[model samples]
Target: MSTYRLSNQGLEIAEQARQAKRWKRQDEKLARAALVSVATLKRFWGQQPIRADSFEHVCRALGLEDWQRLVEVEEERSLDFPQFAWDEFWVGREKLVVQLSERLQNSCRVLMLAGMTGIGKTALAEKLVLELQPLPNFSRINLDHREKTVEFSAIATQLLETWKQQISDSDRRDPQRLLNWLVSYLQQTPCFLLIDSLENVLRGSEQTGWSEFIDPLWVQFFQKLLAVETSASTVLLTSQDSPAQLVELGQRYGHLYQCCVLDGLTPEEQMSLFRQIGLLVEDPVVCDYLSRIGCAYEGHPLALRVIAGEISQAPFDGDVQAYWKRYGDEIERVKQLQQTAEIEGPHDALKLAQYSRNLRQRVRQRIDRTLRRLTEEVPLAYVVLCFGAVYRRPVPERFWLRSLEGRSLDENQQLAVLDALYDRYLAEQVVMDGDLMIRQHNLIRSIALDHLKNLQP
Candidate 1:
């Protein structure tokens, strides 16, 4: 869902209502009565973007909650954005949004939206924020593992920056003091903090299946944050792995904590979203194909988006059928990725498989296809990815270019390949200290390394 600005008539009405209010503490009263922040009430009057719920509360607080009560002869529409306008884009998640909004408004102080990468966790977080508009101090922390601190000082620093508050260097130097300052601030004012991709900090060894990636200080910080009872604040975390402490806390204090486990989209959502990206249509002939694509990718939004992006790019140029025809050879691999979610039929092995088996296979297939295609089309890029994966952190562009020594391709070819991979979302590049640093996702890196390992035999 999305927020909308108020209409001109609505703004005028709000102004009139504000002037007509006799009580000096009217704003405070309305805020408490409607569960809307005073600043948000101001934004509504200023014709700014606001949640639908906020709009309703503002209207009700002004005694014009219903459109029929207002003399809106000029503009027929009271609300700037008609209902379900932007919501049309997010398919089949209306109920989820409603539930999430209710939880945030009611009590779930710390909500964790957990799912695999590219499963729309971040998108949902953004949508929820737009729909609920929790509070003023909203900060989205995209967790990066490259900058490992002794005390996760970066996360704390980012949160403080978002809140526009300052802390002494001495306090920041000490982890416990910084955390205490943070908790104290949240205790004072409401805040919405979304920590995305927490797995970077908490993920265990991929091969061994349970190895902590870094010092558990960040984990401890999250635990402390989650345990706090703040009515006005909500901390949302999106992770692949949900820490047991968070779950246990949620179980004990259901109102203050919630662990939301997300899965792939339904077939309808897949097709609806696909239609937006020009990947699917309403035709009966295409219906089966679209449904199959949905199933093959198991309605993973990122996987579908990648395919759509590739189709819109060069070689295919928005020709979905042509793109399929050109790379149709990879259909076998696609099917291979879709195949066998579990060990076998009617076996105890199949019972032991996690629900994310299909999604992991889907991710594996995506990385695998990219690797194999790069090997044939852009071998230099393939080499770069392989070497970049060798280092867990982001690799500098210079390193990749230098590593291309004695190879047939030059720097330009490597750069072009890198661009293609980055654009396709297979590779990620960041600039640190004036040099471009590139890295792949954990799943992609792991799969790519495994592919290399298998080739050695």
Candidate 2:
């Protein structure tokens, strides 16, 4: 569909109209009306114009006649968005919350949480943000890989506005000046900063100032800030891999930095989430089904969330067991898709080549990155990855041990291959009836199996 973006003037009108009508706090409502995500709306609030159709939809939602009419309203600059506010229905993790709070309160200036995909790190970070006081002093920046423009200056400028830190527009665009101002602001006013998907900053190709110099330089600036006597109240980061720079800082200044490797939710928490999401909780058989499903998915939060959503929707009509029997495998693949989420712009049959190219790039890039790395680093691990892909069920220790037939690796070497897979978050380990079993996500297995088939010659 053709999209519309709100001009600077139109954005101001939307913001004023939203506030005057009490739609500011109703973010989900505004997002639905605009046909976009809350994060997308937050971009508009940050003065980054919205899509054409989205602008019209938002204008209509806010009782404005049209985009042209919205532009007639004077621009409003005295606005500070507190970002997204979600009504959290989280279950369990009281102890973890207490620990996180204590770490931040103490001398720990930077707290890092690392874990496998869909382990609820981001959700917990949002919860901690909500629990903080002086909500205006707290803000989050999601370094989402999908966005076309995610410059450090853009984020820093938005943050300064949110925090009411006065800096010239020209000065805010300069990395050194921005960091200096940021350190000064933190020293005077303690702020809680939560940055999610931090690895995106470090992983991509050399593109812009942020990708090459500014990002690495920003780290050095933070290193100095952390070393100083006066520093932030807390800086939190969540990512799949731990930044080695921060790890070293944590080692040197143990009191100033802390890293927490998150684990999957407890069985109780998983079951509780399913029940709270309005699943078929009353059914006795549903409980048993959830228990099995939960274990199969390793109690990953996103997997359970998708399952809860699927069962709660129509056609199934609250028949949890029926849905389980029919589309359990299909439902499991949703988790994999989420890890490598992508947005496909409108295309046509006339653009068949373009469409096929986009399709191949999306399908190949996700797991191939890791597979190529594994093949180079450890050939044995690559073989294990390929051979193990044939089995859909969780492979037992003996089954994996036997798969080393064509490969000449010893048993210990084979076990190390499994360890490498788990380390990369490509595989998961499960304890089924006290027996350790290894499993990969449904789509992940399919990808590896396809690659293996191509190399069969």
Q: Quick one: best lDDT, which candidate? A: 2
Please give the lDDT score at residue 278 for candidate 1: 43
Q: Candidate 2, residue 252: CA error in Å? A: 1.3
The window of 10 residues in a row where model 2 has the poorest summed lDDT is 344-353
Off by over 4 Å in 1: 1-89, 148-150, 203-213, 312-319, 327-329, 332-456
lDDT of each model, Cα atoms only?
A: 0.58, 0.61
How many pairs collide in each candidate, listed in order?
Answer: 2, 7
Cα misplacement distance, residue 129 of candidate 2 (Å): 1.0
| lDDT of candidate 1 over 1-457, digit per residue (tens) | 2355667776676667767875233354455445454556566566666665656766776777563333333333333212321332355677888998898877777887876556777778777877874356676667634365434766676678668777778866887776776777776788777777665565323222221436556656656666665546678777655554455567777767777766678887877666654443566755565565566555767766555545544565555567556544443233443244631111111110112344346455544644664565445566666655545456576654654677676556556656545533456677888986876554455555555444333
| Candidate 2 wrongly placed segments (more than 4 Å) | 1-87, 146-158, 166-174, 204-214, 328-424, 427-457
Q: Which window of ten consecutive residues has the lowest lDDT sum in model 1?
A: 344-353
Candidate 1 overall lDDT versus native: 0.58
